[model samples]
Target: MKQILKTILLPLFLITALSLNNCATIFSGTSQDVEINAKPQGTTIIILGGTIGKIIRYGAKIQSFIDIFSEYLDEEDKKVLERYSFESLITAVILEVRGVVPVERSMSQEVAKVLAKIPRSYKVKVLNTFGMEEFALAPVKTELKTSGGYAVIGYMSGKKIVVKEINTRLNWTILWNVLNGFILLPIDVLTGAYKKLTPLELDMELNEPGEKLSDYQAQGPNQKILILVN
Candidate 1:
């Protein structure tokens, strides 16, 4: 009788725990992290989101017009839209609507001139390699600090409290449920691990402070900026 009770009761507990774990991943998710290090004391550092955010907003605005047209679209129009992946189209529109705008900061002409005279190096870390499609549309929060006279350090990145998991596969955690016992329930819940983000890293070095940002070539990720100074 005890064995029967264990068999029935244990799987239910595991299922319940797993459901909560999945829900947490879907909702809370993980925050983006960027580590910054810059040189020269009192060197001004500026971090801003790039054109990707702007493009998304423009796309969403355009999609809104498409939605209006859809109301009048005939069967042929429906077929045309059907030719495209529904998930892809919707995700594109959603990302744009929720995309983060770059922060705007300008230097006074006199201050800019003074900094231009000082020679220094620059680094920008673009944390994710794939793309900005996954980030939630929101403003990035910036924090600034001094790291010795040679460098300034801080964290800058947008938050996506809720995110959709894409191109993901089942993992050992989910498979562990096959064991079907109370013993594994706690282990699964405590580990509850899942892949949530694919972030790229961008490292840039400016030979001198006098050089313009456009002069440097950077690789990895679009729309997201890990480090920038202007």
Candidate 2:
């Protein structure tokens, strides 16, 4: 019974930890948005970033399966498994999932069509510029939008993008970490807590240190620049 409890509780605890957006948001620096105001308001914005939460979840599932058969494994096999840890798995998965996801596609292919072309360079800019903030340390959600909706806004800096805040609502329960089936589902619906979307009014500056204006212009004219990220 004790071994069974350990098996069930360990995964449940990890899952619960995975669902905590506050903790994730605090660490995941990927929650910011970029906004640009050019003569043309609806120009296309392309963002390149990806999240790894799903991959991590999948890995945990695999590990759980392995744990189920652990008792039958030889000492050498057990040693091999012991060499790997959950935290390491999560880290590896995050690195693998981090990449580009186009947020908005270009509408027109004309010579003078409005386009805020965010080359891979600017993405690096934002990540490097704002990475030091405490909130940025949160685990990045692979999904573009969280349970609570996000918004874009203006700032004091000339051309800035920021992740103002993250508000997430979960059908949370203390037992969700342990129980399943009919019991857990109903409890979630009945006792779930709701969170209202709080406005994220962060003023993120895009100016990378030691870089001049020439660096910011990866593509397009000056007046037609805006940064819209997911």
Candidate 3:
């Protein structure tokens, strides 16, 4: 009788605990949808640059692979691989210097490094630039990681707008982990379920040519500038 009860009760307890753990990961997820809209309604939104660290790391991995296999490759193949690696390194450095890609370090550290060299309010061009990856028209919805370190740029009527970065904030849903003895806090953090992207919805007004970038108000959690084309 005692053995039977132990078996049944232990399984029940394990099931209960497992079900309670990772509340945020189970409920809130690690990404959020962001909606963007512009006053003129048809502006193009461009997402530029990704985690620089990842790009650099990938390039390094490729270079290492090429070096290991070079004994079997022809001179032409070697030259092609070397050129690709060089271009990748240059691209990573360019994006990093331009503040379009975030370093692999902590956000605070990266921001501190950037602020030391550049003004806090400075903005960088996004459209017609390197590392431009994705694009959509205004009034569009897209999914972004809650970890939040990306850039967005807008283009319309031959004008361009630049948003330096997207930001993230603590997600209240992670607090639910307290009920589970914080057993899931690590999971939430690892999956980025502990935070949510801020300014999930952005609505900006498009100004005519000759308008100063400072004249526009930022609707998101970063420096924004409007670049007018003649």
Better of 2 and 3 by lDDT: 3
lDDT (0 to 1) per candidate: 0.28, 0.27, 0.40
Expressed as tens digits, the lDDT of each residue in 24-65 for candidate 3 is: 112355555567777667766655445432232233344543
Best by TM-score: 3
Judge candidate 1 at residue 27 and give its lDDT.
17
lDDT of 1 by residue, 3-108 (tens): 9988766554544333433321221232333333222322222232223222232232324323433544455444444433222232322222333221111222
Model 3 poorest ten-residue lDDT run:
221-230
Q: What is the C-alpha RMSD of each candidate to the true structure, in Å?
A: 17.3, 19.4, 16.5
Q: Is candidate 1 or candidate 3 better by TM-score?
A: 3
Q: lDDT, candidate 3, residue 12? A: 36
Candidate 3 stretches greater than 4 Å from native = 1-28, 49-133, 169-199, 208-230
> Which ranges of candidate 1 are over 4 A from the true structure?
1-4, 7-70, 95-177, 180-230
